[model samples]
Target: MRIAELSRTTGVSAATIKYYVRAGLLPPGERTHANQVDYGPAHARRLRLVRALIEIGGMSITDAARVLEVLDGGDLSTWQAVGKAQYALDLRRTAGPGGDPVARAAVDELLARRGWQVFEENPARATLVEVCATLRQLGHDDFVGALDEYAEAVERVAAVDVAVVARQPSVEQTVEYVIVGTVLGDTVLAALRRLAQEHLSRNAFG
Candidate 1:
């Protein structure tokens, strides 16, 4: 398809598509002439993925580019990419107004209170700790007390995930399932929790 058709199909602007092509985020289209070019389905897919990383995943261009590199290599499991994307989104969201001493101290205190053994050197860990800080700012201290329970729940979930993955024959398949499962499992568990809560409520009321 021509650039115009590519733009129309992908809902990305022609100029933006050209920029992506220049950035190597999207592959260069075949040159029909000195001024004209044609794109293929791969270009459309790449553009869509780029938009998803930026708009839905909330990743910065640099971070998105790195993720795109990982995805292009196709060596890592899908779960790894999902985890990295989640971590990136968290970092972007918790960036915290760039150096407010009071907020920084509050976040540190929250992490300390929660007994979160975070390595200061690891930005990702710091980002997670900052989420705790954000929660504190929002006046939700329930997580502080529920840390142990949450940790136990996570352990249980991890064990179940491992058992399921163990049934897969190859490492690649296991990784792919883990990646896809990481996202789907969260949704599944959340729905199940609601159902269980409803059942318990009815039983208690009965």
Candidate 2:
């Protein structure tokens, strides 16, 4: 398809598509003529991914570009790519909410106790510690006390994800699936969490 078809089909403006191409977020389509470019399904998919990172994940162009760099060059397994995407979209990596000794120690202890080793660059570590610090600051020690339970639940979800990934027929498809899941699954999870919380809160308080 041509750029127009790609733009219309993806609901991405032609100008913005051009911008993405220039930004290296989307690859240049195959040039068919002096002024025409042909884009395939892969281009369409990548355009969607770029938009998802910017619109849904709240990632800056630079950060989205960096995440794509990992996708292209990291040679990571499906699970590893998915893991890195989670950390890449986090707002904390640039300037985290900061960590005092207590909160930092708790994060360290949580990781150690859970027997999970995450990348040193994962922004979630700092973000989690910051949340713990704020919880302690706000006298919400009980919420902070639920870290182990939360980690357990998260691990179960991770296990299910691994099972799902195992069913992918090819490594290429699996990697693409992970990227799509990483970008959009977060929104799906957050929306569901909100609805669940609302339903539970109404039952408890009303």
Q: Which residue ranges in model 1 land beyond 4 Å of their true spot?
A: 73-90, 94-123, 137-139, 151-206
Q: TM-score, each model?
A: 0.56, 0.85
- 1-206: candidate 2 lDDT, tens digit per residue: 99889989999999999999999899889988998889999999999889887898777899889778766765677667666655655756446457588999998999999999887678778888888898999999998899999899889777876777778876666665665666676678789889999999999997
The alpha-carbon deviation from the true structure for residue 103 of candidate 2, after best TM-score superposition, in angstroms, is 0.4
- TM-score result, candidate 1: 0.56
lDDT of each: 0.66, 0.81
User: What's the lDDT for residue 84 in model 2?
Assistant: 63
Scored by TM-score, the top model is: 2
| Tens digits of lDDT, candidate 1, 33-95 | 998888889889778768866665445777666545544555555556545434433344535
Best by lDDT: 2
**Model 2: how far is 177 from its true place, Å?**
2.7
**What lDDT is reached at residue 134 by model 1?**
68
Task: RMSD for all candidates, in order, please.
Answer: 6.4, 2.5
**Clashing residue pairs found in predicted model 2:** none
Stretch of 10 with least lDDT, candidate 2: 88-97
